[model samples]
Target: MTSEAAQYWENRYRERGRTWSGRVNAALEREVNGVAPGSALDLGCGEGGDALWLAHNGWSVTAVDIAPSAIAIGAAAQQPGDDIEWVVADLAEWQPPRRYDLVTASFLHSYVELPREEILRRAATAVASDGLLLIVGHAGVPHWAAHTPHEGEVVELPSPDEMLEALRLEPAEWTVLTKALVERPVTAPDGSAGTIDDSVLMLRRNPAVS
Candidate 1:
């Protein structure tokens, strides 16, 4: 089943000609720029835009996605200075070989079920002490009246409280540096111009207790 999903995403990227904007997320750029350079992981890194940006900014990046075609496109777009390791694997099953100073999961939340909490927990575990975890996704339904009747799968965008509860990270170990809704111009699937509300969480991991 996982293989099939990966194939599906790969086919979609192949057919559509593009899956991402080929640039880093605007919110991420602002937040990550000030942090010290360290090992970084880009989860669900479609087309590796974010990973490439991280590499250019002095981070050693590991980019992972379920779509093989996305990974291929990302690799092809890699520049000479971009040091990124692109991996084709599902996050539900794949585990990192080592911890990182920064972990980023962006815009991939809508694809999972109840297992998301566990996945996020694992993401937190992969962060080293004094590291950071950044999770950004759509805040809610694109619009109240926007409807895709045939697409039976309903995407539930997690609220700030829900995300905090799901991760279950201890307060003393980490802090929610930022959690807010941001409105940005977006093109909807129907080719209509609209806006998207993105929910962003930036958590800073505290140094481990001696």
Candidate 2:
């Protein structure tokens, strides 16, 4: 991440004072609950909710984010004996030292210019053989999003199939475990409850092929 990009996120995090809910993401919780515990890497780990949850569930986790303040907050929240490593780095330029059993990027959309597709492709390569790569992105705005800042924005979100194409994983080598738009309830900007579609893509690499 450039200094300017880091600064922007730092300021945003400071201003928001907990931009996201501390609870684990519903999609992640549901998906991981059925899988075996293993090493996991969480990209764009805002406040470490998913990282902490993975640790508690017996997985060794490496949580990363571009903002130092956000990483600091997550580090401070760490408990003793928790198997987690907090890292502050730009996911766009980061190279994983080793492959992980699970690589996840949850709602990694950024207002700033970023090589989002390339970053996600790199994340896919970091998944160990027979391991999982899970990417979650917004399918569209909820019905109650009229009052939000995103109301007028032209958000071009890709589908799970598009993500699979970006990953460039061979059909014979990777199994698409889940590819669909799942609905998740959320509190709208106006305090009204609404549902949003979560574009979920989960693929498992074939050990034999890898």
Candidate 3:
């Protein structure tokens, strides 16, 4: 599915003038604000919105995404002093060469077959000791979508608890910081107001005991 997935997003980005809002995701900004800034990894970073925001907030960031065009859009937006390194690779197979202080996956949902659970488990391994793993996912169909991202596909949205189970986190080594369903407001293409439900899971990897 790698080629198919890459092509799907590449076409989507090329077809649209700007596929995503350049602004940082609201949930990410709200959740991590005022925390000590450090190295951050943004998985499936579409156009580097969150990575840019992290850079602005004094974090060295590594942002990865599958589509070259999508990341090219992000690379074009970089400024003179942004401490961000962008990578083009499928998250399903990409491995973090080093650990980070904060690893985030915002709206990592895809229209293609992605081993999301396995990918996320590997993502956790990229978190440094005492670092954070923040995942934000669509909890249900968007209020404005005529169909899901995969048109007419009956994808099941997992509950927060269900997702936690899938991550297969070792409780002795991880602490669940936040688990909740959050509502995000949105504007439909027709300028109508709507809301989307999102699942938020924030985990902190415990420091090694002496």
The candidate that wins on lDDT is 3
Residue range with the least summed lDDT across 10 consecutive positions in model 3? 147-156
Q: What's the candidate order when arranged by decreasing lDDT?
A: 3, 2, 1
For TM-score, the strongest prediction is 3
lDDT per residue for candidate 3 within 1-210, as digits (tens), equals 558778888888888857888999988998899899999999999988999999989999999999888899888998889999999998878999999999999888766777889998999999999999999888977566775245644455776787889998889999998889999898888898989888888899999999
- Angstrom error at residue 130, model 2: 1.0
- The worst-scoring run of ten residues by lDDT in candidate 1 lies at 108-117
TM-score of each: 0.89, 0.92, 0.94
lDDT on C-alpha atoms for all candidate structures: 0.83, 0.86, 0.89
Q: CA lDDT of 125 in candidate 3? A: 93
TM-score of model 3 vs. true structure: 0.94
Off by over 4 Å in 3: 148-156
* lDDT over C-alpha atoms for residue 61 of model 3: 97
Comparing 1 and 2 on TM-score, the stronger one? 2
Q: Distance from true position, residue 16, model 2, in Å?
A: 1.9
Q: For candidate 1, list the clashing residue pairs, or say none.
A: none
